[model samples]
Target: MLAHLRSNPSLLKLDLYCKGIQLDDSCLVTDDGGRPILRTRAGLGSGLEAILPGGLWTNVPVTEPFAQHSPYTLHRFTSGTYWIHWQGEPVTEVALSPRPAWYDATLPNGKEMTHIGTLQGTYLGIYQAKVCEYWTAKPEKTNCKFCSVGLNLGVDDADEKSVEEVMTVVRRAREESGITYVDFNTGHYDGDTYLDILEPYILRIKEELGLLVGVQTPPHRDLKRYDGLREMGVNRVSFCFEIFDPKLFREICPGKHEEYGLDYYLEAIRYCAGLASKGPRHEPWVTNGEIIAGLEPPESSIAAIDWITSVGAVPTVCVFRPLVHTDLEDWAPPKTEEMVPVFRRLYEACMERGLPIGCAPNVHVSLVMLPEECAGLSKKRYPWQRLKLEAKKRMFKYAFERRLQTLERRVA
Candidate 1:
């Protein structure tokens, strides 16, 4: 297990998620140019943001209860280097994900730029609009048991953000951070207005910045809205179902189950995936069905992956993090051995279906293990599919950069 963890950075990432790292007293993350660990983005992320070996950006758990018992500890030296030691033996040297200047900047309205949006890995993540309605449901709240969205809004994110405020932050992230993608995510809103609230921001980003843009919200009752999003140049759409097991899904995500059943989420994924071929040829589009792995059995997670890929949509598997203040705070995270098969299927299934897995430019996500990043965990190699993906990745990067350059020249 030690040798496997040492050799495969991807496996190391999964283990860190399972068994979080303990910070040595010598480590000064912020002073050393590391991003401050803030609990943002639906509460699944509340840990130290650092780059592991092999250029994998991860949000390592540090503040959680389980991390206190972890064998992995992070230490920094006087020479300004950081290393992770497992059982008092050195495992790997790591770099902090740099804190951007915009993190400290404020908008003209006196709102901090970070309150509007923050970088999740290499891209900008904006949790647009107010708290999820489920948290404020009448009589009793029905928010997801594992989600901390309600707790995070006023603490780390603003309750309300104007489109202009978002644009300002987006501009700063693009110019300063060189982010090629801007992702807007929202929790469920009354009357299914999440998409209505997001369209203006999406249009502005597409028209002005020409950066890759993605939207994650509850499945809008009207599926045709996605067709309109495709027409308007939205690059990606994601639906977070949380758990794949039908009974568990109802118990875990009561709001989602009560309003739109599990079947509806699957239908939305299938519908939006079909629109991938209908959108503008120049704009790349993908549909994602997101699930948290630790909540259900690993076999259930693998089944979810197969089902997602079967419909031409990709599966986004997040390690179920028992964030502080959430209902599931005391639950244990899934073991690394249990998760290996789930993530392994994540890679092989994508390859077998010939889905476009890793063609995006400079998209290194810290929240979840991307499908293409799981290649190291699997021994089976689809050499032909791997070759095709490499070709696609190169071509896509060239075209994306060229488009950005043209946009810059036009603005100049």
Candidate 2:
């Protein structure tokens, strides 16, 4: 697939979500022997020496890796040509994201600046506050099995950054990095108290930073809280129902489903969208229904996407990649081929309905970047077929396992 994409040169934006560090590993600079000499969590060029026109490495001061905890930078290569090494296999000749100036900067507080609050490109990824009350409740506990929130928490002394600090970082990021849009996500908080804690920070960023900001939260205790969100300068809102299947929701995200219940989540999404008043500018309060592809059935997954759209929210489907040191580390990610169609179908549906893709910036490829040959009919069909089959296969396997469990219990 990488070779095919490379030969085409027209495939512009690729949403390589859930591929993990291997997707991130795309940023490493390799020696002549193909061994990585340096690894960066930022954009590709950060760790690469100034390679001459002939591709010869030179002695240069390579900036430290950009660390916003996103995989968008991997999409920007010179002229959008790069390679992705997945599970040790090289998916070569892919396009990389444009390196932002703020990829390597230091803040007023002596903190390394790499757009700590938001990332650049077609996808806008944000961590509203580094700290979550869930982590506070169990200091030893990690974030949800799918998150890397603890990566920053484990290293930094401060868990949550002040609104002043966030505003400063965002201002610097926009002025320096050319970041246009921002998405904000938080860890779980205790009760309904966290909304107040987040309001000031959200408002300051919207007013002070002045970028299109998206906020992700559980259903707000008071729907009225959304009024504050809009006044604070928020353009979109995402209430992530991570897994739409009821049983999977309980098993995978017990804390969220148990705390809020599925009906409340649906109601919140509807209410938030209504409050935001969706349209081209404020057309729909961008609502995101997050589906972890490999964990549930394809029909169920597709049904969830339909549900989100039915409620006038966009379905933001993500491949399920387990994070290291999390509860589900032993789990494996869904096949990349399997994810393509789900993405394409959901994207097409949203496009048809005029719903904006709000979860990750990359998902809304047309917003920030465009792939070269996306207009070609064949290019469009390939992703659709591949993703649909993979989604179906995984869903079947899950059902099979459940049936086997039922039989075993009867035998016992």
Candidate 3:
């Protein structure tokens, strides 16, 4: 089932809603930020955001318990052994993500530490503010038609997070879970000063903890703000330009489509990639261009990947989940087969340009396909990258020997 999940993430819906055992809430699932949820697992390739458990799975969001059937269920075969059952047939051995020790700790404000910075896969995800400024706009107008960030995180109308509170959780998460990357993300804010609000927090985290940082926010008019991000040792930055098709982009992300436009996104990604350099500390990924894979016509998604990669940026193709309680809640999820080919192109395009495939095993968010995971592109592995690394090692050895000889001759 785990292997199946890597290639076919749609199966995760089954893993999420599967009902085989009723474990204690604290053990596997617990309330973080007022919603019963599971923080991502490092063990699971990338962690996923999912709804509450113990219900029959439905193709669409339905309140009524009409279909009393689930394709998957959890079964503990014996002590220390577990297996997932598909339609009452045992399919494969599986284990639920272990409850992180830090999840039980408390913050300076006495709130559970988990609420401050929850682990998404191995990366810590902190949504600095609870409500998006766009939500403050007319009810119908928002950047993305399919986003439910504030609602699903159960952070609606909450107070903005203080730097101390967030830093405290970062420290605990590092000490307890060995977290390697910290990703700070925000929905639209009124003043467009999301970077400004994040700067101090980012500076402190890098100076204090020395952790790799990643930020995902709306495009800022002033690209110079990214210079501060580069100096702060940010590993990778991403822009959520949800779709590529200009017309449908306007239909889905009204605020972004009208205000920033697709060209702004392209320019922002290019500017950051050009100057935003994280010298030696962070991993080498420069930028990420995120698109909801099935949001537009599949052809546009392919074109988007091509355009993003051509500009020295990697692409993240997030499979569209039919979010509950959103305007598109009744809409169906994209077919898994359709996404397979689209993801293949995503991988191929990135590999074509030799873009870094993100900070590996760690910081893998289950929400999208990581470039290295694209098996279709793996066949044409670049031997040159390895040869380059080996050459650098050999040159370093010769240079060190020559220096040693010079020092000995001078001393003699």
Candidate 4:
């Protein structure tokens, strides 16, 4: 399937996510002057690099030097030229994300605004609540073994950003950097009352910035409580089901599974989707469900996908990367070959259901990655056709320019 897709030029812009990087134990490299140039790795010798459209390749370094520590890094390289080096060797041309303007500013309370949150790509991520309730459980807890949620809870005093502080950063990011998306994710909190404390912060950011915002939370006690979120001008909501398998879900996310059973999680997601579907414009609020691949069987993963789509929500698939300092650090990630099939199957299923697979805001993969397949299955024809026509126009312009340049040389 990969070979077939590679031959079809129309199927460009492929985005792949997997556990760690390398396919086997071999180091990844791109051919430069007949020499194999080593790229980044996930760990000492782990990582995978794939050739993307236009002969561009993306190398993701996934390295785990310690039992509970794994960090992923991204690098993009062309056949003959280097664009950017994230953490390795320097490149001639680099695309660096600029610090948001508000990062350096101080708030009314004399707190440095930039210390509250940081810019990721074009999105602003604020970690207002630094502690999660799940980690406080007694021995043998199920708080998603792959997460480092509690890693910085105590030491990272600077990690917690206030609502006002985040708002100041948002204004600065928007005015100086033109950022339009903001996401808020929290560590598990011990108390159920954390939501009440967090709500006002979300409301204030939305009221002040009017930017498209996404908030991640466990299923609230009352599903209707989310209506307040929508009213607060939030554009999307993501409730994470890190692993789809019921057994693994319980084992991995014990706190969440025990607190809100699988049935309740699905119910809340469906409720949110229905609410988003009824709004004035019918622009479905970005409802998202996530599945961590490799943690469960393909069938279980597929079932989760089916469940999310059935609820009129989009499933955001995350490749299980073993993070250091997590309980599952010793576990190995699924091979890329194994992951491709799951991705293709889920992509096909979402297409058949007429569900907007990539409609979830701030998500990395969307219809853009599988344009041909998505276009073939879509009810609307304009989007894909427009893209096809644009491609043709660019090709024609290049040919015409080449011919004109040849004629000019002859005249000279």
What TM-score would each prediction reach against the true structure? 0.99, 0.66, 0.77, 0.68
Flag clash pairs in model 3.
143-253
lDDT of 1 by residue, 1-412 (tens): 6787788998999999999999999998988788999897877889999898888999999999999999999999998999999999888889999999889999998999999998999999999899999999999999999999998888889988998999999999999999999999999998999999999999999888899999999999999999999999999999999888999999999999999999999999999999988979889999999999999999999999999999999999999889988999999988999999999999999999999998999999998999988999999899999999999999989988888889889999
Residues 274-389 of candidate 4 have per-residue lDDT tens digits of: 77655534223667776677789877877787888787777766556565567877777666556555566556655555554433233232112232232422334455545554
Candidate with more favorable, higher TM-score: 2 or 4:
4
Q: If both were scored by TM-score, which would come out higher, candidate 1 or candidate 4? A: 1
Better of 1 and 2 by lDDT: 1
lDDT per residue, candidate 2, 276-387, as tens digits?
4533332124556555666776667767777777777766554454544556656654554555555555655554554533322212331111211122213334455445
Give candidate 1 regions above 4 Å deviation.
none
RMSD of 4: 11.5
By descending TM-score, how would the candidates be arranged? Answer: 1, 3, 4, 2
Cα RMSDs, all models: 0.8, 15.2, 8.3, 11.5
Give the poorly placed runs of model 2, Cα more than 4 Å off. Answer: 1-92, 98-101, 114-126, 136-143, 156-158, 278-284, 357-412
How many clashing pairs per prediction, in order? 0, 22, 1, 23
> Which ranges in model 4 have alpha carbons more than 4 Å from their true place?
1-59, 65-115, 139-142, 154-160, 280-284, 357-412
Please provide, for model 3 over 1-412, each residue's C-alpha lDDT reduced to its tens digit, 9 standing for 90 to 100: 4456434333444333222122222333232221134322111111223222221111221121211233544445426454545566655544344457777777656777766777654567787765566666775557366776645455321256788888888988777777767898877777787888888888887666656688988888888878767776676789988799988888878888766888899899988777634444323447888888767878889899898888888887766654545666566556555666677777677656766563333454534556655643335666775455346445544543454456457656
Indicate the TM-score of model 1.
0.99
